[model samples]
Target: MIHILYDRKPMLPERHKGKLMDNLIGNNLMQRSKKHFSMNRKLPRIPINRRFIAYVGDDFHFVWVLDFNYRYVTLQTTKNHHQLNLLFDAENRVFLDCRLVKTLDEKSRKGSIYLYEIINFEDALECPLSWTRTKSNKFLRKKPRNSYPVKLTG
Candidate 1:
């Protein structure tokens, strides 16, 4: 003998009443939660393998251009220089006024990755010759003057 059992109603609790029907009928009306949205950047970044020069204090550091956009640039270098605020591409004759936004140290490669926020961009190709002269003068004035040590005679 075989017994067949049949139930007329679902076994869900009273609090969950009509939730199944509501989900099916109102699926389109439901709005996505805030967590579903991401904090990803809106601008598309262009990947580049070009090497560029950046001025960190008195020494010029060789940095690889990993990627860039109009607002930001990502660079990689062997030396972990914290004061990397200016990126000067002599070949392109382009100057990027930037500030260090973040830094990641790669322990495996023993190198540092830097993400800089581009504050201002100046392209020599678009600017007049006079602009370059004034800009160069401004940079020169910022450099510290070399002080020669005087010979002391006893």
Candidate 2:
């Protein structure tokens, strides 16, 4: 099951973390758990943390590392077709626009899970737990209450 948390947090003081945790965490947790059953049998043991670390590349591209049976799924989004194709060629994964990625009605408006295609990579090359990090001033900060909705493809 994948937990989803999408919101642009303006630059705030450290105290905001506690407030975020106390409030936004519970709303989506129940839904993610319920929808997870719709995906697969023999449900994988998911960690309870709400935040996921993602790597944001040039343009609006972003990818996250997911623990799926110890295998990793790379999820990303791009702003335009050109950028998306460039990313697809570079990453060699099935690419999908964020527009096509569906989310529950209750999802936040911060970002959408668009189209997704599968890509194969050698485990020897990619670290199992390595998450994408934002290089910009806004980090893909994983707060205690932060999480990303999983929109995986076959």
Candidate 3:
């Protein structure tokens, strides 16, 4: 006696309607569909274009930060087999201890792209010496000197 119209046509006849609904519910089709939709959802990432210094052992390498979220970051760096341990962002004065999650190869570019999961993060008031940029466009520690002359008045 009930009518279910779909696209100007009845989806199912009255006798088959209850049976189909019961079968779909009993098979957990609705729950499966919900889970499928939720599983494909991805966290939104904030896009950024910045450079960071990744330290591995005593040596360091430069990496370009492309995008990031709360727990993950995407980077582009030279082809390196060594694991990256620490990342220092000089412009932001933040340090990120991260682990590599994935690496993607670029055919058109010279370097490889990487995805990292941040294990720990810290902020600093001063930039690290190895990553600091000087006025001469070099990555060197600036000498400690007074920028202006001090006048002594007694």
Q: Estimate candidate 3's RMSD in Å.
A: 16.1
Candidates sorted by lDDT, descending order? 3, 1, 2
Give each model's clash number. 0, 14, 0
Candidate 3 weakest lDDT stretch, 10 residues: 121-130
lDDT of each: 0.64, 0.35, 0.65
Q: Is candidate 1 or candidate 2 better by TM-score?
A: 1
lDDT for model 2: 0.35
The regions of model 3 sitting more than 4 angstroms off are 1-43, 80-82, 89-93, 105-107, 122-154
Task: Return the TM-score for candidate 2, rounded to 2 decimals.
Answer: 0.25
Of models 1 and 3, which has the larger TM-score? 1
Models sorted by TM-score, best on top: 1, 3, 2
In the range 32-51, model 2's lDDT, one tens digit per residue, is 67744445535343332223
lDDT of 1: 0.64
How far residue 19's Cα lies from its native spot in candidate 2, in Å, is 58
